[model samples]
Target: MDETLREQQLRMTRFIRDPHANLPPPGIEARRLAVYRQLFLGNVQGLLAGSFPVLRATLANDLWQSLVEDFYACHRCRTPLFTEVAGEWVGYLESREDLPGWVAELAHYEWIETVLLLSDSTDPAHEPEGDLFNGVPLLSSLAMPLAYVWPVSQIGPGHVPQKAPGEPTLLLARRGADQKVYFSRLAPLAYALLVSLREQQISGREHLETLAELAGMEWDVLEPQATALLLDLKAQGVVLGTYSG
Candidate 1:
């Protein structure tokens, strides 16, 4: 590429990021640039706002925009396209220290819903037999584990809800047949077991044995809770099938 073209391409990135810059084009005039500027930021803000409605509700519009702007400028996205901006936006939130800790956590808490909803993961296609706990392995890939410092589920339009849950919240972010994402809470032990199962290639029984040891719960004692959790995981579209391997 020509040096001028390269620099101009860099500037286009900077311009889109800055949101107050001139639109770069022969056809884009001053008024056109202004329109594009607002339209561009508005689209980003709307997608982010949709993902984080509760967090947006916490801040005034300008404040929220400023927060989004800060992340927009500071982070270099791994993706080539602009439409897939939320991943970088979420990464920025989780990394920045200048922002309020709760806000960053809340932003990540919200962004996860969009990530799962838009996921293209198609690896797990095994049918559920619904006997998830009969000495069979259980896991959830479609239903992912998330632990957040801020309890984002409770807040809504009407009121400023509690900042954190009474305990650390273990959430399962799952996608439905229609591709909508839903949040479900899990017990800590259950969450740990699910995570271990999904991560390793161990047989289902071996995974439970390892998990039980890790949790310091005797397998005999935790058997019921573990079984119940596996059944729930199956119902929620996480477990693909019994681990025969």
Candidate 2:
């Protein structure tokens, strides 16, 4: 709380954030400061690398390191837990304008796996064979519906597409009973229905009827397809069960 101590603390943090730009606080040996700086920065870099493995592989060593440095120096994390660091990194990426178009989407695709793995909630017990039309479909606690401009799931070392496809990518990722996260590509209509199920507490029949009306299709045409899709999702553990009452 002393004036001199406060100034020293500020200088030390600045040095930790950007050691090349700012010198260590007065009377601290450069060797001692270098060790602290390397230890902290290296740990962050390693964590980011572990969190976004495919992103790191796509960008290669130098570009990935530069991106990590920028993230470290610019972002002030809200939570102290290391498990939440990837979310902070994703938020930081969202704010940056100079990153490649697919970078943020790719980072998010990688982050969701960690999010599901660490989630404390479990899927509600429901009959896997429940009817979707007559029942209220319950989504898995660990499942998430994600729509992205780029085909983030397909991007990696050898298959980075420079431009987004004509249609936006739709994906459903869920953690199964085996505790493994799996991703499934979804049709745009199917993705919309899944998102609607999450956002609106409507019966599966009503949800598909609304979607059919919005798309100018009759219930007879959409119902069978929607029912089949829901059944597949239920089998996949994305949709646990449905409530008819």
Candidate 3:
């Protein structure tokens, strides 16, 4: 590329990113550049708005606009696909310190909905059969465990916490057979068990046994409670089926 054209391209991008701060290149009319600026910025803002509607609502207009401008000017998105913009935005929020403490958690809480909605992956090998206790419990492919300190699942227009709790809020978001995504609040132990089931790929009984040992409880006492929890999870479709492996 020619030196002048390269400089023009850089300047054009800079202007588009922060039109309020940077003037358009010398030859280009300010009016035409303003149009381009709006078109570019508006599209990004609209996409992010759709992705994180609650976060946008929680912040005042000026704060939201400044946040979006900062994102546009500073963040270099990893993916080229437009649909992946939300993921990129979440990544950007992970590194920022100026925004509210809940911003990153809330952003990820919102982004997971989009991810589960768009997922096409399936667990066709597992037949929805066998006893959950003896057979290996297969976690729902669509199930995602999120541990956040700010109680992000509870945050919205009505409620926004100023500080994170001492203990993390564990949530499980799962897509059911009906294709609706549901959010379930998990007790710390339940959350750990589900994570262990997924990570260890073991039998439900074994998972619960380990949990019981870790908690210094007798297996007989924990067994009944563990069985009840498993049954509830199965009913909710968060536990898809049992795998014998």
Mark the 10 consecutive residues where model 3 has the least summed lDDT.
Answer: 122-131
- Which parts of model 2 have CA positions greater than 4 angstroms off? 1-3, 122-131, 243-245
lDDT of 1 by residue, 198-221 (tens): 677565566677778987889998
Q: In model 2, which residue pairs have backbone atoms overlapping below 3 Å?
A: none
TM match of model 1 to true structure: 0.76
List runs of model 3 lying over 4 Å from the truth.
1-7, 19-23
How well is each residue in 5-86 modelled by candidate 2, as lDDT tens digits?
A: 8999999989989987887799999898889888999999889989999998999688788878988888889999999999
What would you estimate as the lDDT of candidate 2? Answer: 0.86
Candidate 3 lDDT over 122-146, as tens digits, reads: 7746647668888888888899888
How does each model score on lDDT? 0.69, 0.86, 0.86
TM-score, one value per model: 0.76, 0.91, 0.91
- Which parts of model 1 have CA positions greater than 4 angstroms off? 1-33, 124-138, 156-166, 243-245
Choose 1 or 2, whichever is better by TM-score. Answer: 2
How many steric clashes does model 3 contain?
0
- Relative to the true structure, candidate 2 reaches a TM of 0.91
